[model samples]
Target: MKHDIVIVGGGVPGLTLALALAQSTSLSVAVLEARDCVRLFKRDARVSAITQASKRIFKKLGVWSAIHAQAIQSFTRIECWDEAGNEIDFHCETLAMSALGYIVENQAIQFVLQEALQSYCTAQIFYSTKLIALHEKEDAIMLSTDTGQVFHAKLVVAADGAMSFVRERAQIILDKKDYNEEAIVATITTTAMHEQIARQCFLKTGPVALLPLSDSYRTSLVWTLPTAEAKQYMDLKPDDFCKALTCVFSKRFSEVVVVEGRQSFRLCKQQAQQCVKPRIALLGDALHTVHPLAGQGMNMGLLDAAALFEIIHTAIAHHRDFGSHAVLRRYARWRKADNFPMSVGIDWIKQLFAANTPVISLVRVSGLQILNRFPTIKNYFARYAVGERNGLPKLAQ
Candidate 1:
């Protein structure tokens, strides 16, 4: 069988990309998911901090209304402070918006995207199917699935995770940095009302972010720390874990209760040397993985998808081969240029906070104080976080 595009992964970015293309054009899109249908439809425990730009993309795809209604939590303010109380505050009112960003469950996004895809005739989701072999020819790309089926496509996309099978088979090299840290994620109940605000505290270990959830007093926590320490935290009893968490940010809330079980994953900073080659392209974590200090990982991946969709629109308008080197190279140039600096900047911030020397700590505190005093600087950073800028894709704009 043949398709216009074959996506290797059925994750959010891949499903979103297929939905975007299917809604606009008559592209025959097939998503090869390795998991069974039951597993693919199961609710995910993790939630992603979706930026305004990504929300706009979802809106354009006509999936935002359903996702927003399902369980999206909007945070209007962000308060980030160091351990010594030096803080920088960003408010949506200062930027003339209703929300800084949104907290969306990964399962909610996938379910919405999947439902939307079902409405389109051009999209197909093949469950329990995995791409075992790929062959790129002069015209179309060929793929062999675990089910012993062969499919051909003009373009292939790797929306798989950071350890992308397609990216590895395509021979794309990645630049990687081991953070030597693990992020523990879970939902917790706090004594204080979050009041539609997201708060983060910088500690010698790493940053702890309490993102607002639909429940007033409950928040989703993403705490980063050393791997060894993270293992210890994971081993603690639920009540003891809550006590330990309360001790870390004792000033913010009176009591902390772990309403959900804990989940831990190692953090790393990685970027592909190139995002595309011939008929192959990478999006989301498959292309780049950034430190989650700013909660930009999923947003960045959505932006990558948006950018590629825009490029494909132009290619089709001009009757150019969408999978040709000329087309893929343009995507690579646009995305790599946008993703490289952001990845590096996030790594720098992670390192800056990781340093515990007395002089560095003093400097970090002073910098936060100064940044807080300057509204202009703070607003600029806020705008960046919201994905508002010139030259962005039409959806993001």
Candidate 2:
């Protein structure tokens, strides 16, 4: 197979990349996936509490209808508290046009994205086609698949994920380490219905969040705890887990005596030594994978796709090839600016709450109090989560 571009990876970022890039060059683009097909892609139940900025990108891609149909709208409220159940912060009433953020199940999102990508454009999806080896030349890169077929493309975009095959073969270095915490994620039915409020309680060991879902009677829980503690909790029966949850959540969640679809994953922080190199580039988790504390993992990837799409066009208009070093550098520059801050922010939050010292606790809890009091400050941060800059890229705004 031959294409102007070969995108490796078919997850959220890769599909979004296909949609974003199709708008740029008239080049033939092919997305290669290892999956045999896009069936009920049972992805992680973890949902993205996405910002409005990210929603705008979907709107531009004509993906909003699918998401809206499948997603729950979160407006009006977000609450945070300390380990002692002291309210740290709250967001409400007015913070731009909507509330703080939205939460969408990852699997449901993948299903919708697959549908939109298929219907929105003419790009072909190559399922179950895994990249086995790569050889690059001045004009093109040759990709050999597991099935013996070979592919040729002028540039390869890797959104393959944290353990990216292309990124490794290309020899891009990364800095990574585990956060030493495991997050137990699940959906639970609450005794008192959620009135559209998102709440988080940060413990000395970690943080537990209850994000609003579609049914006012149910909520999503993401509990980050010490790895050992997480393992013990996961080993508990459903009933026991629900009882334990009540102890942790208390009255805020009302009754929480039931939960479904329980799952757990270890937390990690990984960043690339560099985001781009010559004809190859990384996007999404391939570039940087942060902790799930903020639920912005996919949003950051969407931003990367948006920026790269625009940069490719600008490069083309200037008569520069899309794979040129300068062109790739432009993508890197835009991504690095945001990626670094986000990595730091997520890590800082992890460290802040992970501490047990009383003084640290006072500072952290008091800070949340101050943040809760200021809607102006909250709105500004909220805008960042949604990818809304006053000067957001056309695809994102």
Candidate 3:
């Protein structure tokens, strides 16, 4: 098969980039997905806290409507409290915004991106194909799959996720860090209806965040705990698990029961040492992994895809070399500037919130009070959450 661009992952970032780039007259694209097709409504225990920037990108890619119904409008505010669940509040109104951001399910977003890609006649979609080798010639990149099929393209995108084969084959190094913790995520039914407010409770163990779901009464939990404890929680029966959770999380939202299945993911900080490698480029989890505390991992990946598309599209429009070092370097520069800070910020949050030091607790609590006291910083965050901040591609902006 022949294409201008070949994306190795059929996940959200790969599919969205294919759709976004297909809009440009200069490129023809294809997405190679290794996973079997997933059906809608299958419980995706993972939920994402999407920023305003992510929403705008969806609108531009023409999938916002498909995702809107399933998305929970999170206009109220997000509150973080100490272990006691008291002595604090942070309101969205402080920034003069109706909602800070929105909560969306992982499955729905994947479905929407898949459906959106289907609308692009210029893009080819492939499933169950895994890249096995990449041979970069003078003018094009060749990709071989495990099935022995080969593909040639002007550029190969490495959206193949955290352990990207493309990045590995190209010999790209990653700056990686691990918190020695695991995040246990599950969907649950809450006795108390969530009033559109997101909650993150910082405990000595780790941070537990409750995200709103489509239904008023349901919410999702991402609880980061020590690796051993997370495994223990995963092995517990539902009744015992809920009881143990309530002991730490409390009865603030009664009737808490874990969904049908639960999963634990190791928490880590990893960023690609290089974002662009000759004919190959990296995006999304392939490039960086932030702590899930802020839920910005996917958002950062999508932003990378958007920025790359802009750079490639501009070069193609001017009839310049789109795959040259000059063209690819621009994308690397843009992504590093934004992804670097997010990686650091998330690490800071992990260290800041997980400590049991009395002084650290005092500082974190007082920090919240001060944060709420200043409308300027609050508004800055509010704008950034909504995608008004900066570094977005033209289409995303």
Candidate 4:
């Protein structure tokens, strides 16, 4: 098959990019997915915190309505506190916004994206197809799949994730960092209603976030801790796990009980040394992976898709080669400027709270209190949190 663009992965970023391009231009697009289409719709235990800006992008792509129809929980109040008693709260009403953001199941987003691509976008989707080789020609890129299928495209997109085969074949080096911790996720029922508020508490070990769900008493848990501790939690019986979690979050909720499966993933930081090279560009986790403490991982990837689309559309309008290094580099530079600082900031926050020194702890507490004291500052942070503050792509606006 031949296409103007070939995306190496069919996850959110790749699918969003294809949808955005198809909706905005006449670019021929193809997505290579390693998993079966049916398996892609299976219920994903993980959920993502979608920012308002990302919601706008989805709306622009004509998929937000479908995603909204699925199970989603809007959080209007965000409360964060440290073990030292320093705390801050952000309410949507205070900012005159509908909600801070939303919590949607990962599978819900994928399902909707898949549906939108089929109904609204003309992009060809090849499932159960894995990239086996990538060859960059003088004017085009060629790809071979595990099934012996061959594809050619003017440009290649590496949305294959952190361990991107496309990126590896392209020989892009990643500046990686391991946190030596794991994030444990599960669904739990709380005696108290979440009240449409997202709560994050910084513990001595790590951060635990209880995100509101469609069910008022059913919340999603993302608990970050040392690798060994996370393993222990994952191995614990349901009742024992509830007891351990109750001890961790005893300050906020009561009678927490595990209601579903538990899973854990090792935490890490990865930023590709280059997001673009020759006729190829990286998107999503293929470009960067940040700590999940702030729930910005997927949001950032969505923004990348939006930004890349913005550049490519402009290039096409000018009759320029969208695969040219100049066009691809523009996308890389734009994302790095915004993504780099945010990654560093999240990393700093993770480290600051994890510090055990009394002085550092006092400083961290003081910082939170100061931010809480000033509504303007808190609102500024909120804007960024919803991905509407900084340089936003046209679609995001």
**Candidate number with greatest lDDT:** 4
Which consecutive 10 residues in model 1 have the weakest lDDT in total?
36-45
- Ranked by TM-score, the better of candidates 1 and 3 is 1
Off by over 4 Å in 1: 38-44
lDDT of candidates 1 onward, in order? 0.86, 0.80, 0.80, 0.89
Each model's TM-score?
A: 0.97, 0.94, 0.94, 0.97
How many angstroms is residue 304 displaced in model 4 relative to the true structure, after the best TM-score fit?
Answer: 0.2
lDDT of 1 by residue, 1-397 (tens): 8999998888889988898899888889999888665334443458899988999999988889999877889999998877777778899999999899999988888888888888888999998887788887988889897778998999999998899988888889988888899999989998888899998888988999889899898888899999999999989889999998899778865589655858999999888888888899999999989888889999888888898888888899999999998998988888877777677778877877878898888888777777778888878878987887666778787
User: What tens digits encode model 4's per-residue C-alpha lDDT throughout 223-311?
Assistant: 99999999888888899999988887787767796558688999999999988998999989999999888999999999999999999
- By summed lDDT, which 10 consecutive residues of candidate 3 come out lowest? 83-92
Q: Which whole-number lDDT from 0 to 100 does residue 207 have in model 1?
A: 96
Question: By TM-score, is 2 or 4 better?
Answer: 4
Runs of candidate 3 exceeding 4 Å displacement: 39-41, 71-75, 84-88, 255-258
lDDT (tens digit, per residue) of candidate 3 on 4-59? 88998988888888888877664788888888766564657887887777888888
* Overall local distance difference test of candidate 2: 0.80
lDDT at position 16, candidate 2: 81
lDDT of candidate 3 vs native? 0.80
* Clashing residue pair totals per candidate (backbone < 3 A): 0, 2, 3, 0
Which ranges of candidate 4 are over 4 A from the true structure? 39-41
